[model samples]
Target: MEKLAASSLPMPTTIIADAGFDSEENYVYAVGDEKEPRFEFLIPYGTSVQEQTRKYKKDIQNAKNWTYCEEEDCFLQLKI
Candidate 1:
């Protein structure tokens, strides 16, 4: 980011990255703290995307089969 800001080239209007670059710090950096963002970004959460795949869904221990209890802020594995 420092390099990009210091460069003489024109600022890009948008940025696209794979799941590998997805992180809270990256998101905050791309979008400035102020009202307006520094640049637009398109990044998807890695886990969310993985969960939709057939391989991930077939796993019995997958989080998708577990229930998230907001009140307890924990995941509950209900017995069958």
Candidate 2:
């Protein structure tokens, strides 16, 4: 973004990017100073869609699938 801002090319009215470009710094830069804005940003969180899928929900490798053992204070390994 710094390079783009310093470049001679005209700034775009809106900036559309994938999850890879989603970050706090990018958001702040796009918002500009005060109430002004450099451009409209359309970026989604990286896990926005993947977390809702059945594959992600059932995947043994995903931490969310691990069952916590309160007494042992650890996550039980899931058997295939």
Candidate 3:
């Protein structure tokens, strides 16, 4: 992350990553204050009550709304 921040390449406004890099420390680093370059990160949290609830899962699956990625061969059910 530090290397990327220091690199000459253009930085993106947003970043998406798997659960492995999901943590408070990383969040703080990626989303710094106004003095720093801000980045909006999309990282899924670990399993929790919301994810375990039957109603939540049912709603997500029943919504029939998903964003598919052909390259990754996956579907993302966006709530927003």
> Largest TM-score belongs to which candidate?
1
Query: Which residue pairs clash within candidate 3?
Result: none
User: Per-residue CA lDDT of candidate 2, range 1-80, in tens?
Assistant: 77877999887877889999878887887887885887787988788779888888878988878899999999976954
Candidate rank order under lDDT: 1, 2, 3
Candidate 1's residue-wise lDDT over 11-66, tens digit each?
Answer: 88899899999899999888888857899999887787878888776676877778
lDDT of 3 at 25: 82
User: How good is model 2 by TM-score?
Assistant: 0.54
**Which pairs of residues have clashing backbones in candidate 2?**
none
Residue 52 lDDT (model 3): 66
Local error of candidate 3 at residue 40 (angstroms): 1.0
Q: Write the per-residue lDDT of candidate 3 for residues 1-80, one digit (tens) a residue.
A: 66777999888888988878879888878768554737778888775436667766657564444778799999888764
For each candidate, give its TM-score against the true structure. 0.62, 0.54, 0.53
RMSD of each: 3.7, 5.8, 12.1
